[model samples]
Target: MKTLKCPLCGNELTSIFRMTKTGSLKNKYGCLICGWETFELRKNENLAWKDAKEFISKFPPIMRSHQGDNLKLDFEDDVLTLIGKDTSRGKLYLQNCDGDVEIATPEDVEQWPWELEQKGGSNDI
Candidate 1:
């Protein structure tokens, strides 16, 4: 295992268990040094071009077709945030997950811009 700095005390982090809708999830070494625990999902490592294109049409030309393995995404800005380490069992996702905040559905999240995938609306840039 790798050692990580604690966001609380700036000391080494430790292993800990956290309860979630999908039972238990792994963390980037819980913080026992200062008791400041983080329950955020890391960026998506890979996302297929098709999946991205399905969401946004302004994707790169090479992305016109499904390429790559997966797309690393911002959980906070995810249209659906599934919280699970594996594909088996169940998949928990957040509809409108935002930076450090989110909800189970898009309607539940009260934020602007909805997401990057959506454009041409009154909230457009």
Candidate 2:
């Protein structure tokens, strides 16, 4: 079986069983780290597998670790710029023409456009 990951946070997932009120077991894949639960069940294993695959294909890999106060990123075009950082609060300040915005960490910047440019082709974002 292929491994599944949480669609929202990109964390590892585990298969689990829960008892419904009807006293039947329903199998689901859940992410312990982010508390994401899949609604699809093993009762329809094929459909559940398809849904899981579709979910995983939608998100970027979660490569963000706690960089603490040391996180830094520099891009040449000023498309994204770091304006402030508060490691104690786990917040980062960024600014672009869209205006200033706060983020949880540097990894939150997925840079989808830059990635597409690097690949020399369009990709699903």
TM-score top scorer: 2
Where model 1 places Cα greater than 4 Å from the true spot, the runs are 24-28, 41-125
Q: RMSD (Cα, Å) of candidate 2?
A: 9.6
lDDT of candidate 2 over 34-62, digit per residue (tens): 88777767665556566665666655332
Q: What is the TM-score of each candidate against the true structure?
A: 0.25, 0.41
The most accurate candidate by lDDT is: 2
Candidate 2 TM-score, C-alpha based: 0.41
Give residue 111's lDDT in candidate 1 (0 to 100): 37
